[model samples]
Target chain A: MKILVSIKRVVDYQIRPRPAQDGLDVELTNVKMSINPFDENAVEGAVRLKEAGVASEVVVVAVGTAANQDVLRHALAMGADRAILIETPAVVQPLTAAKYLQAIVQREAPDLVLTGKQAIDDDAAETAQMLAGLLNWPQAMFASSIQLADGRATVVREIDGGQETLSLQLPAVISVDLRLNEPRFIKLPALMMAKKKPIETLPAADFSVSAPVLTVLQIAEPPARKPGKILNNVAELVAALRAEKVLP
Target chain B: MSVLVIAELDSHGIKAATRSAICAASQLGEDVHLLVTGNDVAGIALEATKIAGVSKVLHADALAYAHGLAENLAPLLVQLAVNYSALVAAATSFGKNVLPRAAALLDVAMVSEVIQIINATTFVRPMYAGNINATVVAPAGLRILTIRPTVFEAVAATGGAAALETLTATAESGQTTWLSRDLVQLDRPELATARVVISGGRSLGSAEGFKSTLTPLADVLGAAIGATRAAVDAGMAPNDSQVGQTGTVVAPELYMAFGVSGAAQHVGGIKDSKVIVAVNIDADAPIFQVADYGLVADLFTVIPELEAALKAE
Candidate 1:
């Protein structure tokens, strides 16, 4: 069995972003970029599956600009056997990304496709399911644990009030959640080896993007959150909460 | 153009979030109908008709949709999409799982986690973990939406007498099979409904620390328990206990945070909380800026002190 992991380069989880002057996007100048934290978990999951001998090979794929390859390289260092970058200059929405990924999936034909439930940037949490729909495959989304067996993948997923386990046929899509795995750091030797790995690139112009679209009208800092004064000790904090009447 | 709202019930019967989704649907300038899919749930559907702004109830009475499995229900929604201009559901796990699939089948984009309905076709939503809010426009076609209910006031559950319409069960999609579920049955107040909430972070170190330190405080205050995504990721809390962009969005009257250095993802979930009190050793933790009362002290040191103070009172 082979596994494909989708990677995305997003604004670092820690950066508090402000809307750009264009009023349609976030300010990118000096903003840090990194592999989406959940995508890192997806990579770790694929690596673990390979290590457990359930997966024959792991391919990391991403759809974005040249800078996104850095994210793919990070995945390669983590353990994916190869990388694919569908080079696109467009701001790929969830539906469009899913379409591009579907194109790649048709070519790769991996037994399982794994990706983050949502990216920190768009936070759509829509791509994997969309890809599953386009591919006509079952999706066990927000998977916390996955096990491969006779032509089936059993996924333990996180839901609102509890956890549910679902079994899907092979060649399905699974979206990784936060508790799926702790992503490992890239080692020095692995970093050197990843540089030598093969990375295939495809131009986005080859595929017509999906329609039924959305347009961002404006993006502004959510009316500034009032910064409360920092109190020195617990006594002051308690006194304040009492004064505010949340506590007696 | 009519709006169809998908409603999910809690063990206690219908929840306020569903009512809020109906309230949101009503604002879209269209006839609002709600879909309730579950086994042996027609009685609940009858009860559901009392919610304000719900003009009709579309009940899919079947065992297959009891769990709201995305496989079986997504197709059902797609088949029913012909009559409706917009399909709306509260941005819970059920909405997250089903709407995207329905939208994909329709070959349309689903505008998700929407906080405000600017008009019929436009919306305001928080992105980049609530640090920035974006106004988005859905083009001409089916408009699919998953409403973030915390931002909308729930309409009254009594007022309207809506007629119940039974929907036929579509051909079952046998692609995925449900196995079992491990549910967290907490007797305490639920995070979304609780007046007071006590949340923890990864700095709690381990599940043992979380249970020992946070549970007592929660028990004493009769507050719900919530966790930052970091704590849930670290296995310090259950997945359902998570509060963030991907987790439970909570806005209790009093939301107390311990050992949580507020990351943007976690902050996104707590914006609705009325009075935020944060206790962290790191004075510069971003949570301090959003908190109403910020204490720069170790959680271990202050939590016990505060617990003692509350107990003495």
Candidate 2:
């Protein structure tokens, strides 16, 4: 069985992204970038599945510019056998992303696909579900636990107020949650070995998908939080809250 | 243009988040209908009708919806979506899972996790992990929205008597079948809806320390407990207890972070919290920048004394 994992390059969560000077996009020039935290989890999930003998090969896919190859290499170092990058410098929305993913899914025909619940950058949390819809495959989101048996995968999803477990047939899409697995650091040797892995780059324009549906009117910083006063003691903290009527 | 609000429910009735979604839907269009799907959601359907501004409730009673699986929900919503100009739900987990699938099938763009409704075809949503606020405008097609309920007050559940309608459309739950559930049922309020939250960080030292130190303060304040990603990564706290960019996003009336030197990711989650209180031994923790109240003290000693002081009150 082949497992396809999708990864994205996002600003490191530790580094705050500043809005670009145009006020229509986030400044990405020279920003610290890393594999999206959840996508890192996706790579780990796929690697573990391959390790447990559930998967014969793991292919990591990214749907962005050539720069995305950087993230795909990280996925390779994490144990994916091969990588594919859809070289599109254009802004890729979820729908556009799903189309590119669908193209890759058709080509790979993997038994299962793993991706982050949401890309921390867009926070759209929509690509995997859209891909599932396009492929007409079963989808499980926010999966905390996944077990494979008898050509089916059972996933425990972190839902509102609780977790729900379900078993779905093969060729399904599952989005990884935060607690799925802790990704291991890539050893220097593994990073060097990843240089030999095959990485196929496809032009994003090759896929005939619908154009982006949403138009960006403006991008600005979210309202700034007000600066606060430091309380003298615990009593002062309680008293200040009481004075503000936030506490009774 | 009519709107359909997807209703999420518990054993008691419709959830507060769904109620807030209904309110957001009411603002989007005039005829707002609610669809309640579950194995035995007749009572919940009735509850949905009484929610203010709901003109009607569509009940899809079946075993398939017992767990809110997207496999069943997406097709079901697509079938009923023809009459509605827009589809909406809270940006909660259920909405995040189901709506995109339906939107994809319909070949429409989904306006995700919006904080404000600009118009029928426009909205403002946070992007870049709450760092940038972007105003998005979509075409005149069916607008799919997942609203953050905390940004909008939930509509009252009483003072309405809308009619309830049952749908005869069949739905396939796909190959996915409900197996089991692991729920965090606590005596205290859920962190998502909690009015007050007391969170700890890596300085809590260990899981045992996280529990023992925070439980008393949580109990005394009648607040839900939370943790920083640092603590979660350290195995000092559970994943669900984590509040950060990767974990659950929360905005409560009062938020108190103990020993939490806030990282941008953790602070990203709690930015919407009305009043933030930061307590740390370090005089210049990053958390103090966003804190409405900063306290420099040893949490180990101060928390216990604070609990006693509140108890004395």
Candidate 3:
């Protein structure tokens, strides 16, 4: 089975991003960048599938500028067999990203597609479901566990109340949550090997890229909490909580 | 312009988050219609009709919708999208799962986890795990949105007399099938909507430690229990109990943390709480920055003392 996985380059999850000076968008200039945390899980899942013999090949894809090759290289070091970059300088919204992925899915004809549940940058969590809709493929979102066999994939999904298990036909889309697996650490040997590998590049103009539908009006910091007081004892804390009507 | 609010359900009736979504829908436009779809969910639709701002409730009951699988449910939304100006739902797992597919099928843009409705076209939503809030203007066509439930007050549940409309057409994408469900049955209130929450960190070494340390305090306060991702990762708590950027984002009336270092990811989820109190041995723990009250002490000793004090009172 050929598995295709999508990864995104975003501001590192550890770094707190601030709004730009002009307040039009988040400040991305000179900030630390890394693979989105969940997408790393996606790449890890795909690599594990190949190692387990369920997948014959794993191809990792990203949609960004030349800089996205960094994340592609990171995926390669994790054992993805090939990399493809859909080069675009513009900020690709979820639907437009899905359209690009749809074009790739048609070209690759992979049996399964994997993606991070959501990107930390936008926190939109829309691409995989949108891709599934555009491709007319079944999707299992927020998958915590997955088993592939007999042209069907059984997935355990994390839900609000509990876990729900579903079986989807092969050639489906699966967006993974955090609990799926801890991504393997990239070692020096694999990193060195990945650096030498060539990445296939395709211009975003080649695909049926649609016009942007959403416009950013402004970006600002969320409301801040009031400064708190440090209590010296449990009794003082309890008394203060009661007076504030925070304790019953 | 009419707005369609998708109602989420459990075994009992309409979920609380769906009520909040209805409240958000009412803010967007005057005509608010709710769609309740599931197997034998007519009762839920009837419950929806009683919500103050809802003008109509659409009920679609069928076995194919029992699980509310996105494959089948998205097509149903696609069928209904033409008549509505916007489709709205709570940004819970169910809404996050179903609405995006419907939006894509209709080839429209969606703004998820909306915290404020700036106007009919503009919205405010958090990005980078609540660090930054972005105000976005959606396309002029059909708008798709999911409201962050905790930010909006629920509409009154017993005021309106909305007409119940039964929908017969069913859309089933046969590519996916539901198999089973494993839900953690909690005896206490749900973490998302509880008035108070008591959460712990990895300092509780084991699952046994996690339960013993927090359960009594939770019982005394009548609050729900939650955990940091570190605790869940360490197996001290169940995955469902995780409260962080990657886990359940809660906005309870009061949130209490014990031995939590207050990482950004963890704070991202709890920043919306009305009152936050943290207890930790480390005085400089980051959780104190966002907390309304901070105490430097051993959580093990603090837990017992606090529980006993509340019990005595």
- Tell me the interface RMSD of every candidate, in Å: 2.0, 1.4, 1.2
Task: Provide per-model DockQ scores.
Answer: 0.68, 0.78, 0.81
Task: Residues A1-248, candidate 2: write the lDDT tens digits.
Answer: 99999998888877888888988788989999889999899899999989999889999999887888789999999999999999898658998889889989998899999999999888999999999998999999999889998999999988876889888998899999978988999999999999999999998678886645798888888888887998889899878888877664
lDDT per residue (tens digit) for residues B209-282 in model 3: 99998998999999999999889989999888988788889998899999999988889899999899999999
Q: After superposition, how far is residue B68 of candidate 1 from its true place, in Å?
A: 1.1
Ranking of models by lDDT: 3, 2, 1
Which candidate model has the greater lDDT, 1 or 2?
2
Query: What lDDT tens digits, residue by residue, belong to model 1 across residues A1-248?
Result: 98999989998987878789999899988989999999999999999999999899999999999888788989999999999999998558888889999989998899999999899898889999989988989898899999999999999998877889998988899999877888997889999999999998888888776566688899898775577878888778778888888873
Candidate 2: lDDT of B126?
85
Question: Which residue runs of candidate 3 sit more than 4 Å off their true CA positions?
Answer: none
Task: Write candidate 3's Cα lDDT for A143-224 as tens digits.
Answer: 9999999999999999987899999998899999998999999999999999877799999988767845689989999888
User: Against the true structure, what is each candidate's TM-score?
Assistant: 0.94, 0.97, 0.97
Residue pairs of candidate 2 with colliding backbone atoms: none
lDDT of each: 0.87, 0.88, 0.91
| Clash count list over all predictions | 0, 0, 0
TM-score of candidate 1 against the unseen true structure: 0.94
